[model samples]
Target: MDKIIIIDFGGQYTHLIGRKVREKGVYSEIVPYDMKIEEIDSNVKGIILSGGPYHVSEDSPKIDPRILDLGIPILGICYGHQLIAYMSGGKVGPSKKKEYGITYVNIINNNDILKGLSKKEKVWMSHSDSVFSLPDDYEVLAYSENCPIAAFKHKYKPIYGVQWHPEVYHTENGDVIFENFISICNCNRDWKIENLLDKMIEEVRNEVKNGKAIIALSGGIDSSTAAMIAAKAIGNRLVAVFVDHGFMREGEVESIKNTFKELNLIVIEAKDRFLEKIKGVSDPELKRKLIGEEFIRVFEEIAEKVGAEYLIQGTIYPDRIESGLRHSDKIKSHHNVAGIPSKIKFKKIIEPLRDLYKDEVRKIALKLGLPKEIVYRQPFPGPGLAVRIIGEVTKEKLEIIRKADKIVREEIEKSKIREKLWQYFAVLTDTKTTGVKGDERAYGYVVAIRCVESREAMTARFANIPYKLLERISTRITNEIPQVVRVVYDITHKPPATIEWE
Candidate 1:
């Protein structure tokens, strides 16, 4: 059972490297940076050093250099590249000018892993430090305009280093690079979704035992997949709780209901007096906290009614990191953690998908025979339209946003662009602009349409939407939603901006 070990150095795409290895039918696992290098023996055929936020010359944490001495095929990425250079008698320094986005790399030759790749290719680069010098035993493989040593390989060892991320979608031919590494290492092709399903079923059954399991069903891919898996493992003992917080899309409630009905699982539909409580809230964090606290209250009451002992929510890896729980800085508030009240009462909490990322969850969903629509649905935040809208939430605002979002969906579907995008919708803002409605001066809200294409929601780029399609959406939104006087499109990517407006 040959496998590849990925050492996590805190870069956002560390797990993505492991995913790429797994996609090539190879088994991979993320190990802590402090893990012993001697553990990489016998069955371990390859090693991948992941990128991180820390600079190599900084007085921060460092990994054991014995990892390079393990004598296996090693590939260092980004910070991994810097770590190898700094620890192996080389020099590293801050980049004179940071290469934060897309850049072109020139492959020096057609040898080693760069064999089939083109002489010139676009790769994503994000670093504040660069390797100033390479060791005497190493040879340069590729270089960019700014960073001279973009790729390198040692002469006597099977070790390689890449200054850019090969796992990111922005990098061209990234997957093929991993495939070559896996093939060259002769790693086993045993990691498949079917195998994972059997393992998860057994694990869930043992964890739940005879106790009941309660899953918070939000009609999204994460929770819906969690609910389905738990139901299969525990039968009727799995209780599904759906909370309607008055911020969902137009058809979310009925869509969730239909899903559970098809599965024939026991569902407890809980609807709060959403309009009464969140009618005029403005602050983003405050809005999340209020919704979270209110949701816990509803869950407590529903748990009492159903007599369940465990409260399960779909807490993904990114959600935990974004909530500042994992090895990541605080990015945003996940409703399950940031929004839920601290004083929780009744039933222990369980999260099956907590350790898995968004892409992994989709694989699990596909393995479990979930519908295509449900499996590929865009990642929607638990706060729903409440967070997407830029101001205080109200019935009128919700209605206007819902209709505008519906128009976006309809036009996208009609134009056949829905399949090409990851997520697309409309948002209402607090500011209003004056416009002419039937030759009369009228003041109404501003709506911004967001459409993006991404493999996973971790980082995304704006979708190159057709101008004619945008025209149709803009026209329909202004004509249908009287409260909306103008429509604008968001053309920003993820690094400088997040997916949502708030």
Candidate 2:
């Protein structure tokens, strides 16, 4: 397969770049920044240098200087862009004014890579350094207000570099630029996630074999899909365990059990125990670590009872990425990945969907013919409402947030806009606000509503809900949930605020 090789330099969106390439029907493989030059084969049509949190100095990461001599088409992003310029004798320095998000640039040249894009392009940027002077044989292609050299290209070589990230959704005409690059690489569209179903199932069978396995089925799309795939591989040998840690939304456990009744579903009632464990933990990361460790201990107990030797989880790519990879910084600790303690009892753990993002997992879910409710279900954090309730984990706050989240879902569904949404829920904040109800002064917890639209869990933008709908939701939340004296909607995107407030 002709593939695009992305050299990861610990950028949070490194995997997102690969997912976008694969989204365009071309295979993309991510390798370390120090991957040997010889390891890159002729099948690799092009190379993309991913952005990272580097300032590009003596301590910055590097690729083989021979990479430029390989004559392969190269596209460098943020740090990659600076590296290309600095290596080839261009001057780079810290920016007097940094470009963080939603910046506009004017094109100076109509490069083939920027074809189909307008003269002025809106892009996402998070860079602290700027290329001050161009290298020999390199010319500026675009410039922004703060930086003179926002983009550049080789004079005689098919090499391009951009100071902004094109892989993110915030960039305008990102698809067009990717298509133009695909054309420049002279590649064909041959990659598809749906084509790998059989192979994935076979791998699951090989990993478990005859050993009984317990799956941490959270009833979300990721775990539900994994459960279906694993069940097909090992049949009744797969036990789907749904833990009701007393943090789930109202009636969620019953809805899940009824959905997967055909499978050997076991519901563990440990709500009180989880609340007790998470009590007084104010830090979100600490709460995740505690909940994650408790979940493992619960699974270990079940594993011992069933005599199972392996544990299966619905962990996906975003979960792993946010939890922090060795090369990348930790955004937050996912209960499944970073939250897992160092102690375990299972012989091995299996995550069938670890490599896939949410959208890709949903594609496989449809291929496996999972129920629509399960396939299109909104994403839920493994730590549940514990992450939604800020500051402390209390039964009262959980009840307020649970009812508010339920109201959010009901209103979105009632408005017939559920299908267009990725995930919609309510967050109970620690701060209390003053309100007047029936001429009575009341002070109570503030509830926040978060509804975002995103392809994968990596990047998200706030949904533009109708005003009447917002009015209706706010009215209902305050009216129904007396503890919520005030209701406010979250207008911030993912970079500024995550889906869950924690």
- Candidate closest to the true structure, highest TM-score: 2
Q: What number of clashing residue pairs does each candidate have, in the order they appear?
A: 0, 0
lDDT tens digits, residue span 1-502, model 2: 8999999998888888898889899999889999989999989999999988788887789898999988889999899999999999999999999888899999988668888778999999888899999877998999999888988999998888989989988997777777888889988799998876888789889998889999999889999989988899999999889999998988998898898788868999999999999888999999999999999999999999989999988898888878887578788999888878887998888988887888899999999998888888888898999999889988888888889988888899998677678889988888998999889999988888899998887888889888888899999998998887898889988876777776
Q: What is the lDDT of residue 387 in candidate 1?
A: 86
Q: Please report how far candidate 1 places residue 41 from its true position, in Å.
A: 5.5
Question: What are the candidates' C-alpha RMSDs?
Answer: 2.5, 1.5
- Quick one: best lDDT, which candidate? 2
The whole-model lDDT of each prediction reads 0.81, 0.88
- For model 2, the superposed segments whose C-alpha errors exceed 4 Å read none
Give every collision pair in model 1. Answer: none
